[model samples]
Target: MHSEHPPLFLKIAAWGGVIFLHFPLVIIALYAFNTEDAAFSFPPKGFTLHWFSVAAGRSDILDAVMLSVKVAALATALALVLGTLAAAALWRREFFGKNAISLLLLLPIALPGIITGIALLTAFKTLNFEPGFLTIVVGHATFCVVVVFNNVIARFRRTAYSLVEASMDLGADGWQTFRHVILPNLSTALLAGGMLAYALSFDEIIVTTFTAGHERTLPLWLLNQLGRPRDVPVTNVVALLVMLVTMIPILGAWWLTRDGEMVAGGGK
Candidate 1:
């Protein structure tokens, strides 16, 4: 009794949902090129690249962008190491408190961002650590690890353990086996996970709000720009840049992992 295609209403609803979600992004993009900069007007008066040039000349914006990129890079690096190791440990192991550990690993990302931010802030204060660049990197890493862990663990599930055994049986040492066998198999998954983690860290705002004392990431800069009505066009340009930076990595991750079932050493 199943139909070959979804009902017409379902299709309409799905498309409508897509548009509803993306329309704001479309408007932001359109406004980024608008010539009239006093305030957003109905039906853009003109389209020009003036705002893009203006944004490029702002030192504050440049500094915010550099800080964001640095934070995201460092956070993604930490996540890659910790997440891969955690996934490797939990993938085929049975141990006491294993489930608890897994849950804790994912807890940061599942909790509301504000809660995580507050918790991280309190922890830093308890440790007498000042909220700054390092704090922001650590806070971002907390959730970024979850992204990498999920991707790497999913890849591990599809990967064949027999390959590891075979490498060992062939007289390869632990490091050699990992380098030749495991790393190759995990390369795409790690890259995809790192990309996703980078994207997530790049646009994060809530956690950054609590941890970034006297330091402004791009998102924080954009949030502050909201108070300056004259900077609407510049804000739109910067917002569009944020979208592109985050979107490219996400799309790259999707492309890398789309055929996830066809993993190396999988079908044996």
Candidate 2:
């Protein structure tokens, strides 16, 4: 018997779809190496590393990059803590409105960015909370929690409750069981979740726009650069850098989360 493969037309369609999604990213990356600083001419007018040097030297861009890094780091940290707690609370528990609670937790990521942004903005105004670095971190954390929550809850569902029961029977307290037993099982999932949350927060624009009062994060900086044709090449370099930074974590998360046999004689 011969193994069945996808039809040739389907294979072609899949490749075409991948190309369609990635071709623009390739163009942006290519433009980063263009020698012509101002205009995007055909053939790129030759290639050089000048824009990279320029991007490195720009203080404003450096500041924006730092701000984005700070915000992403803070958001990811918050998400990991909160999301893990939420997963632990909801796991293996049945209650009224549980589904509703889960839906509400996912609302930030499920809704359109603009809608989330507007809603957050309105809430902040209502509460008299000024928008700034803290607000930006809070905004990013809102959606970031969903990523961590999804990864954690999925892992939790797969985890065997018998192990936790065994730990309890062995005189281990809740903290000890969680620290030794559950933590090991959840390490990879938490890592992948944190990485994904960091990536999302790093590149977020819409929610950041509403929450960031004077803080100019890297994405907002890129948006501001659109009006300057002379800085196009430099901006492209920055954009490429951002893509690479975000892509690594995302790819790492994907690799970590790939389907594989779970460790035997463990929670999951």
Candidate 3:
């Protein structure tokens, strides 16, 4: 028997859809190197690395980048911890309202960013907790946790609980069983989840806006730069840089999670 290929028209449509979605990102990257920086010009006059130097020299941009890095790092860490514990508790368990509990765990990411932001802002105001870096991390973590949770729970379902039992039967303590058996099984999933959580937190704007207050993350800085028309090229350079940074982790996560068994688990 011969394997069938997708129809030519279907292939063209798929490529067209991908190009349509990503072509504008290509445009932004191209304009980042444009010599004519007065405003956007098609077939950019020439290309140069001047804007990259300009972006590098700006302290505000550096600060914003650093702040975004910090927030994303912190949020990813919190998400990994919370998500792993939640997955461990909820996996292979029968309990009351389990589905509802799982739904609540997922609610933050499921809701619109605007809604999440508003709720966070309102809660902060009601509690007299000022919006700032910590607030931003909290807001980002709420959604980031969902990503980590989903990844971990999928892994948990694929894992063989019997291995854990066997480890215990062979004289392994709870910590020893987890350290030797469970941790190895979860390492890749945890890494993938952390990378995804980092990527989401890095580029988040809406929740960041409400919780950031006077704190300027890279996305907020980019938003501010948009108002300065002459600096648009520099902004493009920064945007390109952000894209590159986020792309690595997103691609890494995808690669790590690509194997069915990787997301699923090793045991049957």
Colliding residue pairs in candidate 2? none
lDDT by residue for model 3 (1-268), tens: 6659988899999999999999989998999998854347777888788899989999999999999999999999999999999999998689999999999999999899999999999999999999999999999999999989988998888799999999989999999998999999888889999999999999999999999999999999999987898889999999999999999998898888888563632234
Tens-digit lDDT track of model 1 for 86-197: 9999987889999999999999999999999999999999999999999999999999999899888888887899999999999999999889998898899999999999
What is candidate 2's TM-score against the reference?
0.94
Candidate number with greatest TM-score: 1
How should the candidates be ordered by lDDT, best one leading? 1, 3, 2
lDDT of 2 by residue, 1-268 (tens): 7759978999999999999999999999988998755347866777789889888999999999999999999999999999999988898799998899899999999899999999999999999999999999999999999999988888888899999999999999999999999999899999999999999999999999999999899999999989987788888999999999999999898788886343111234
Which has the better lDDT: candidate 1, or candidate 3? 1
Candidate 1 error regions (>4 Å): 36-39, 261-268
Model 2 spans with C-alpha error above 4 angstroms: 1-3, 36-39, 260-268
- lDDT (Cα) of model 1: 0.93
Sort all candidates by TM-score, best to worst.
1, 3, 2
Number of colliding residue pairs in each model: 0, 0, 0
lDDT against true structure, model 3: 0.92
For every candidate in turn, the CA RMSD to the true structure comes to 3.1, 3.5, 2.8
